[model samples]
Target: MTCSEPARTTTGRLPGGLVTTTRRIRRTLAAGPRVVIAAVVKALGYRLVRVQYHGTLGEADGAVPRGTTVFDDEVPAVANLDPALLGALREAAKDAANDGVEFFVNSGWRSPEYQNRLRREAVSRYGSEKEAARWVATPGTSPHVSGNAVDIGPSEAKAWLSEHGARYGLCQIYRNEPWHYELRPEAVEHGCPPMYPDPSHDPRMRQ
Candidate 1:
């Protein structure tokens, strides 16, 4: 899932834990440049805030390490995907690799709890449920939670998929997120369906 941009307003107080963490970080960085210290503190605050917002996730929920490939059976993110869809992705990845392209799984199957956390974070970032709906789907409506969707990464990989994915039944599902893909077995013959502008425009999300 995409991380929300750091909140724009600077008026709110930091959480007590975050405040204490910041002081500790500042002391640890006493000899660092002013700019570097400030940046580090900000980054730490963002991470702690996310920890508070999303709790914690582990392998069972499909969290995977960086560079996880479609063929990695040991990774829950790759293993828990719908079998047919996973097969298509593996076939596509194998072909893509011949051309020096690698498919890295940025996200795959997610638990409902993780999906809900993401939706709530999106709402906090965008300031309303209406706006957040354009990006994050509700837990019950998210394809990721149902093992039917995958978000791939590395610009070259996404570009390669855009050009050749449909041949393997993998198709981009949203106009705004080229990284997001789903399996459409019919796409191998007739080509993929039209793209939704965003999650908000998808009929499946209304359910």
Candidate 2:
């Protein structure tokens, strides 16, 4: 029997080594969509360590300072999101507050680098990229990186948003991730579009 080398050893760093790393990424992706995400995170150990110590890669990477809220306009994670998305979240939060439900920003805008780290970590925790897709997404396709999505928290807040969000253009994007939401202005009149089962089911992720 033969053993394949660990994926990490096969990957290389940038400035001169991306060629090898990128080829590995291509080969892993070509194998199947499930393994594709593992390749993207193979060489991210150092950056992931930096993220752990600093809690972020800094404002340039759309890192939300700890304890960020929907109203924290000064935080990059809140400020960097699409203005319309921010507006909708703020509006929904205000109403939710009236119901004794305060919205906490678990995640908002993210730099592509941060998104990649999350995918890498998810893959590690879940034991495979295929399962990770149920939670995290690749940087290129993550709504958070695009500033179009937010992950709110607190069971009460999620419940409040689930019931009242559409009136303000905030709608949960995935059935499995009830805390995740995106702005859809038309929802105010027509209601939100159907939810995707998970990130993998969203057609946008393929791109």
- TM-scores, all models, native as reference: 0.73, 0.70
Note the Cα lDDT for every prediction shown: 0.85, 0.82
Estimate the lDDT of model 1: 0.85
Stretches of model 1 off by over 4 angstroms after superposition: 1-55
Candidate 2 lDDT (Cα, whole model)? 0.82
lDDT of 1 by residue, 14-65 (tens): 6875687666666766565654545564655442133222457776787879
Give model 2's TM-score versus the native structure. Answer: 0.70
Please give, for residues 41-90, the per-residue lDDT of candidate 2 as tens digits: 55433212211333557766876667789899888889889999998888
